[model samples]
Target: MKNLSLQWRITLMTALLIGATCIFMNVLIGYSGRHYMDSIGSHITGYEETGGEDPDFFDPRRERLDQELTIVIHGAQESFIATNWYITAAAALLGGVLAYFLSGHALKPLRTFAAQVEKVQPNNLTDTKIPEAVLPEFRQFSRSFNQMLDRLDSGFAAQRQFTGNAAHELRTPLSLMQAQLELFSAEHPEVSPETADFLRLLREQTERMTQMTKTLLEMSELRTVPCTERIEIGPMVEEIFTDLAPLAERKNITLKATGDGTMTGSDTLLYRLLYNLTENAIRYNRPDGTVHIAVAYEASCLHITVTDTGCGIPQPYRESIFQPFFRVDKSRSRENGGVGLGLSLAWEIVALHGGEIRVAESSEKGTTIAVSFPTDASAD
Candidate 1:
């Protein structure tokens, strides 16, 4: 019943109700007619007349009356059944037609509200609102929906503004601190081993903070990035690998790229997306491990997958790994100076482009991360 459309459901219910009513009326009429015939037969045969005829006497008049009554009763019953069937069928047909149109009309407001809701997106969050419905129930629903959208639009705006401002303000101080440290280290070349180690640690932590701030700013700004460029994913992947090849070389990891496709989105965001995934693959991989990147057009979408022979992500941690500051291996992540924002940022970038990303496969042997974007050749 849930799988059926509203119009058909209404039609079926109406037909059943009319059909039952017709059956009840026919039964009542048939019962009344039988009772009336029985009374008439009793009178015609003189059963109520005491001592009017001998018992078992065959009177032609009375016999003819009995036969006529039986015939009349059977004929009336047959006629009533045939007539009721035609009336019932006509009533069912009429009820179904009326119910179909009535149901569609009754649901018009809901359909209108759905259409309005579909036009609301992050960029147009404040521009769209469901109109007041004529029906009281639908009007209440519209009001609630509009209120929710208002809260979301306002909250998102505040968060984005705060992130962008904080990141921008922190960068100058962070950069200055880094410069001062470099100068201090250079000036005090004869410092003790303990002092040198402390300075190195300080510098490393400073660099990590700077990178984190930069990533936050990028993620905040991504929501407003317009999708107007046709990015050839093949060349973008190639360029990212070229820049990170030296890093991969340190661990003897192999970087490979295969397949190509095109999508319409911000080139900068797309680069950041691929860069983050590829970098993580190389960073966490085993010595002599291989990182393979593949791109292809599948099911009307452009798919990009990064597979690495790294210690696979544990099943329990896979879902949370894409959350900001969430690390599967906290000790290893800290040792590698990772703040755990890479995957989170990458996920946001994909979402901004109306795409999807997921951990396609993971095991002790390797892990695969796949991203897909709707294919659009016109943008190319």
Candidate 2:
């Protein structure tokens, strides 16, 4: 009972009520019927015992008539009880069936409402609402849900605005600091060793901050980017490979790509998704390790897979790796000049295109990240 759905619960409760009523009615009717038959039989039999019938009938005849009356009354009572039991059982079962179907029909609107809610997303929340013309029972609920969505949409919009503003504001100070440090270093190349080292650290930190801000701004803007462009995979993969060739060479990692597919999405965002995956593969890989990317369109979904023979991510961290500032090995990520936002931005890009990304498989040997963009995202 605790685990049953609302519809089933309603059906069962109704069935139980109907069954109880039927049982009570059957019992009452059976008792009255048995009593009436016995009273009538006794009344007719009593006349004979009082000597109301002919004496020629004799005492043996009287006994026989009374015996027949007793037999008939008891038999009718037993048959009446049996019939009531059968009818009660039938009524209970029939009530349960009708209740089950009726409950399902009554709950259909709720199911449809749930499905529509499931389709709502952050980017598509503006103007998202359930119709007010729904069933009376759901009308108030629908209006309240829409109002909640409105509040949520407004909140998200404000957050995005804040992010964009904050990122832009930080970029200026970071650029200024970087530029001043460089100019000062150029002017005084003969500074003390300690001072020079300190300046270099400042420059590095400032540049890292700048890049972080840029990534943040891009993430916030992703929602506004249109995903209607038809982007091809082969050429884009080649471009990413070309851009990262120097880094791959420095790390002694091999790069490979195969298969081509086209998907409808923001060209820039799709490129970032590919580039981030490929870059991470190369940056974290073992010396002489290999990175392979494959693209395919199958079963109406565009799939992209990036496999790398790297220091494999642990099982638990696979899901966490996409979070902003999340790193499997903080020191190693820093050494790779990563501030831990590449994969985060990749995740944002995928979401903007209404796609899915996940670590397909991972172990001590290697890891494969799979991405899929199913169907057209422009429906939003």
The superposed Cα distance between candidate 1 and the true structure at residue 229, in angstroms, equals: 1.1
Write model 1 residue lDDT over 1-380, tens digit each, in one string: 99998768878998789778877887787678767766776675576344566766767876676688779877876787688778878887888788888888988887888788886766557667887756898878888988999999999889989999999999999999999999999999999999999999999999999999998898788867877887788899889989998999999999999988777788888898899999999999999999999988778777889999998999988889989999998999998879999999988887667677899999989999998876553222
Q: What is candidate 2's CA lDDT for residue 336?
A: 84
Lowest lDDT 10-residue stretch of candidate 2: 371-380
Q: How accurate locally, in lDDT, is each candidate?
A: 0.85, 0.89
**lDDT for model 2:** 0.89
TM-score of 2: 0.86
Using TM-score as the measure, the top candidate is: 2
- Quick one: best lDDT, which candidate? 2
Candidate 2 lDDT, 315-335, residue by residue in tens? 889899999999999999887
- Candidate 1: C-alpha RMSD to true structure equals 4.8
Task: Pull out the clashing pairs in model 2.
Answer: none
For model 1, what is the C-alpha lDDT against the true structure? 0.85
Per-model TM-score, in order, reads 0.80, 0.86
